[model samples]
Target: MAKFKLFKDRKGKADQAKNNKFVKLGREIYVQARKGGPNPDANFGLKTAIHNARQINMPVDNIERAIKKASGNGENVEYDEIYYEGYGPGGVAIMVKCLTDNRNRTAADVRSIFNKRGGNMGESGCVAYMFDQKGILIIDREKFADLDEDILMMQSIESGADDIVTNEDSFEVLTHPHEFESVKSAMEAAKFEFSSSEVSWIPQNMVGVEGENAEKLLKMMDAFEDNDDVQDVYTNFEISDEEMARLG
Candidate 1:
């Protein structure tokens, strides 16, 4: 199993958990409604979004209000989902995913962050070829004590999943983009409690950063994640457990 040192400590989890769920839910509603329709039951993406929002303890009222707002007559905030590729310290490839109403504003903000962090943003397709976009489903381990790993794996494979990884705290299932819904439904049928399900870019190869370079790269990643417009960030960098402990 490949362990990501970036998520080693509980500090990031605690900090993110404090973020206002209303705001997050609002963004999700906006994206889903804009992409599909306001009705979650009729829209698979919207249904997934709402499910994920609830999983994070977002208030029901907030979720409802967001849906209502999206359906009602209002200034439609047109969000364009954009991805930026760049190289951080030690030549670690980084990909940032953002949803913004203005592409120019988002691009400038991303570029500024990269520049400040001693990194440079690259042209489109520069670093993207090094990654594969896949649907990832994450589930909490405590929910299923008697869970049959082999059975779950076989079910996922039959439902179009490409791989499965079980960790100490969670189980991550990977699937093709088109089969995401099917695989997710299979897991749900098996009574699995999903923590999150989304399409993300996974790096095919990883770079090893150490010493000063690793510190700088981590700081840059933190800054990118803190941006309001930024939704997700992916990188192909591997850090050892010892490095994670020292940083933590």
Candidate 2:
């Protein structure tokens, strides 16, 4: 199985990075609620938004405030979902997801970042072809110290998961996008707690990056995540664990 790279925080920035994630999640909840009513039970998008927010440990008060702002008649700030494809250092394919109130501003900002950071933004569907959307559920090892990996794997497979990848500190259950909900429900029914869960873009291949290119790419990623309009950024860059430690 290929080890795909997902967006992650760089060393020494975990605190600010997590807070940034909460802001993005709050925006997502507000957008989803405004688009599909505030009721999570009735609105699938809103429900998923709330789930993602909770996955990141977003505060309950913040979640409720976003929903309230969306449902109430007071504030009206419509956000548009936009995706930008690009190439970062070492020719690694990149995909940026954004929720913005202004298309032109977001596009300009994204393009500028790409231009200045050893990258080039491309048209829609440019690098999107290199990725497939998949659902991932991560279970922490310490959370269930007595859990058997084999039994958990068997249960996940029976529950519709396609595969289970064991990492040093966690178990990652993979599922087809269509079967994600059923598998998640089954695991929940089995009392399995998830460290994190999401339907995300997975790269088809990995492109190795090192030295200056790796540094440049990491900076580019940080730039995108720091943008208020940007939500998520995905890439196919593969940096060795050793290189990552050195970079840190």
Candidate 3:
């Protein structure tokens, strides 16, 4: 959910590590294009990666360069997509997504972060059962000032979206992984702009974290995010807005 601790600030915000974000996004673009070819129209994953790049204001030149590299112009070395599951402080389930050239190095990096911060890295499928891969789309409330809530719901439902969620500030549309593109196209056709869109590992339930454990967990998460190989990190932990503000 958007209210989840890390995502609350991440949503509609510029990434803190811009250069790392560029590398991560570029690698994803390259992988998708390499696997499915440079044509986004025929490759759903590449199309989604491109949309995500634009959402973060990645330069068009950077995106094109990545495509070219992936399309046989550059080294074209394969990067492996790996998932590392672990438990953070206070039993918080953590799932890390990575694109790496070296499995041993990535595994060691992830394991060290877990072990250093009162966490335990586990075997594959360790905590993955707690999450679902869902297509999430965030719509800024101010962007479509004239849109009615009912109309938005109708469009989302008819477009094959799985669920609609809302907060005081924005609307979120969820869709199955297979239906993501069709739903996104429908929303775009209706002129609805998204603040963010991605197929991510969404936690099925949330765990509460506070006090020192929360502090340690945040540090651990920061370590993971700062890793060049780490692409995305998901955790089941949640903290109140007040607690989050205080952490700041």
Per-residue lDDT, model 2, residue 155, is: 95
Rank list by lDDT = 3, 2, 1
Determine which window of 10 residues in candidate 1 has minimal summed lDDT. Answer: 1-10
lDDT of 2: 0.84
lDDT by residue (tens digit), candidate 3, 177-213: 8888889999998888887788888899988888888
Supply candidate 2's per-residue lDDT for 230.
90
TM-score of 2: 0.90
Per-residue lDDT of model 2, residues 1-248, tens digit only: 22322435555678888888899999988998998899998886787778878877899999999998898855888899999999887788989889999999999999999999888999999999999888888888877789998899889988999888787888889999998878988998899988767777888888899899988887887888788899887788888888888888
How far out, in Å, is residue 126 in model 1? 0.6
Worst 10 residues of 2 by lDDT: 1-10
CA lDDT, every model vs. true structure: 0.78, 0.84, 0.85
**lDDT for residue 225 in candidate 1, whole number 0-100:** 58
Instruction: Assess candidate 3 and give its lDDT.
Output: 0.85
What's each prediction's clash count? 0, 0, 0
- Ranking of predictions according to TM-score: 3, 2, 1
